[model samples]
Target: MTDAYYDFSPLYRSAVGFDRMARLLEAAQRNGQENGWPPYNIESTGESTYQIEVAVAGFKADELSIEARENQLTVAGRKAANDAGDSTERTFLHRGLAERDFERRFQLADYVVVKGADLANGLLTIDLARELPEALKPRQIEINQPKPTLEGKSAKSNKAA
Candidate 1:
């Protein structure tokens, strides 16, 4: 855990192309003290593919929403209110499972795109894949072979006897 008020001025002064990383670190530090609800896991399914599973026990498929915009992925869940009358309500002796609504966000790297999402049992899984553009992909440069020059060949050619 880091102090929420940590100064990043030194990092900014000595670094280049690291502004996004600094922002991410600052955001994490600021949200460090927050409670970890609806725990999640991020896993690499392939060389360039990933999956994020979040435990949303009581939330239904219809009650959850997934959105991807720019470089951010947001998942939110809300329990719908029951339409039944309050007269038929029953109290629980031990309510350990939390049914509170929650919203979770994940920052994605460049070229990473959300493939799909599925909710089954009590887990919500979001799939992602990285697709690099042709211009950005690594390429091999061909080295040209130099043409052989004719030895002793000048502006005047030697006459043969």
Candidate 2:
């Protein structure tokens, strides 16, 4: 039988010591696939800003979490009892709403960071900003004037003197 191996080290090369860690996490994700949970979108807010909106109908602000460590953004959700003693048992004719717990991760760029998160009208919006490093920015080099050549004037006079 042939051996099956998966390598995912390239995804987290920008982060320190996270290459191997990401590889393990990716392997685990492939091995144990969970239920397909929520609907989301990633929008380019501007040149340096991005926003991720998830449709979390039943989840509240406390039930969801947005985490950014190294070069990865993870969105997780947990179902908890409502404050007004709501029922955990959801009955649906078509059964489309996602009430199960889930964790979704996205690989971010080198300078990308999460700004904040907001929940409104059954939507959770997470904002991200990309901050480039000073050294990585473009810098213009100054062109200096060329020095004068002495060969045009001094050779014959200095030898005769």
Candidate 3:
């Protein structure tokens, strides 16, 4: 990570536990490059559901692959070796379409899993949902009410006398 971002070095020396934050900062710096090839979109479908749409124009289903691991999602497309063919055999005067291979990575939140992916009409859409374990989900705890003590009941009887 850059030194301008809080000078994370002191976090390791002066702080007791901020290593995870420092590591995350480093990862962010590595992924901060502005490579705009193959545009994409992220939208919220539900309270805990999300969808990512990436333009895979010239890529086929077989040429693309998606994998999620350690809170990171990677989508890569590799064209076949013989797809373009020999220049002598096939030549293009104007090749505007980006048939070149590319890979995109996204940082996912905790408990976020890639449910499914579909390639349709040159668009690759990936569905994700946050599935928290039952232990982590909020639940109503039943608080037991204490029964009336015998001492309190005897005191009430004495007061009545």
Candidate 4:
């Protein structure tokens, strides 16, 4: 696969604290042509909440794993190899379903965290939430009125001498 280069110099020059976003965009463009396997979906469940659902047919709970570290979420699955002595020798005419191993990763934004995960009916759902720090959360700033000057008059006062 060919790696494509993009010029984000303009964005870097004009934007502040957006370096992570630019890096994510570049990484996505580079991997845009990769194979799609073990399809997944990301949905917003509520304010500051999200869910990721992945289809993992034919895979037992023991064969799958999910991990969250720093700002990355990774999901991996592997089916145990069948022992030669356990199964009768049988030839398959056609194999359509994919039971192969797969690994998928997602980049999470700042303050985003994985709350929990569950698997039901062959679907693996991962819950997430964004919890911003108190300092980062928006707050109303009080606009203080100007105090009276030394001349015994307020800045906004229009009393005639």
Candidate 5:
């Protein structure tokens, strides 16, 4: 994190409603090391909806945890300790799979909420949606239309003159 890859303070001076983005960038810069370990893909599933799929090859459903709070989503995985003498336990010949503990943080946009998550076939899929409030959604505004008058004030004045 010493390389200072992202310096967003300068843009903060003139920027409005972008602090969340800046924080996201800074968090990514700080957690650069843990960003690449668990490969993940973010795909748009619908209008204002998204799905994040993380490659958790050797993790079980109970070994993983997902939490969403304050517009930030965190997914973590931890391996269970091996039993003293398990009948089905076997030694790995080459040990290539990285089943190590890891944590991944995702910064969500405004009003984005985690709907649900599922772990299947070594892949974790999390669903999110941008549930914009009613006030923020587009709506029709009634425009007042003046009623037609038989004679306006200016016209009456001209007739009197």
Candidate 6:
């Protein structure tokens, strides 16, 4: 399939890190379009802040796990059947939403961190902030005063002689 945003031709001769990001985007696009599983949305909070919200109903806080490793953000959920003491039979006539389990990953920029997560009304919201490295940020360079000209130096030496 033709890439929607990435051009492999230019990336072939480029650096390795960009190639990896391209590959990651490709994988994400494929997985994102493949199974319309729990829908999600990504929005930019500011210049370096962002948020990703997913519909995760019937999932508790303990049933979810979020991890950030090697510039990858992974969100996973596993709902285990409760089988202790309490016994109740419940049936749903029209069951549509998924409450099973799922794993979703997002490739993050350097120094980007997962700030926090909040679950409300069946939506799982994950916040992220991109904190650029010191070296990567722009800095002002102080200019020094110019040294005495060659002509001035020569005149001073002649006066001394």
List model 4 lDDT by residue over 7-90, tens digit each: 877877787999767777765874585578889999999999999999998888999999987688889998899877887876
Candidate 5 Cα RMSD after full superposition onto the native fold (Å):
5.7
Q: By TM-score, how accurate is candidate 3?
A: 0.75
Residue 106 lDDT (model 3): 88
The per-model lDDT (C-alpha) reads 0.86, 0.80, 0.86, 0.86, 0.87, 0.82
Candidate 1: clashing pairs of residues: none
Q: What is the lDDT of residue 89 in candidate 1?
A: 79
TM-score of each: 0.74, 0.66, 0.75, 0.69, 0.74, 0.72
> What is the per-residue lDDT of model 1 for residues 98-161, given as tens digits with 9 covering 90 to 100?
9999888788999999999999999999999999999999999999997775797743553441
Per-residue lDDT tens digits of candidate 3, residues 86-145? Answer: 666657899899888998888899999999999999999999999999999999999999
Model 4, residue 54: C-alpha shift (Å): 0.4
Model 2, residue 83: C-alpha shift (Å): 6.0
TM-score of 1: 0.74
List of clashing residue pairs for candidate 4: none
Best by TM-score: 3
The candidate maximizing lDDT is: 5
Q: What is the lDDT of residue 146 in candidate 4?
A: 75
- Tens digits of per-residue lDDT, candidate 2, 1-161, equal 33455666566766786665776577466535644457789999898999999888988898998888868788988988455776576667897776778787777878999999999999999999999898989999999997775776776786887
Off by over 4 Å in 5: 1-22, 85-89, 149-161
- Which has the better TM-score: candidate 2, or candidate 6? 6
The true-structure Cα RMSD of candidate 6 reads: 5.6
Residue 72 CA error for candidate 6 (Å)?
A: 1.5
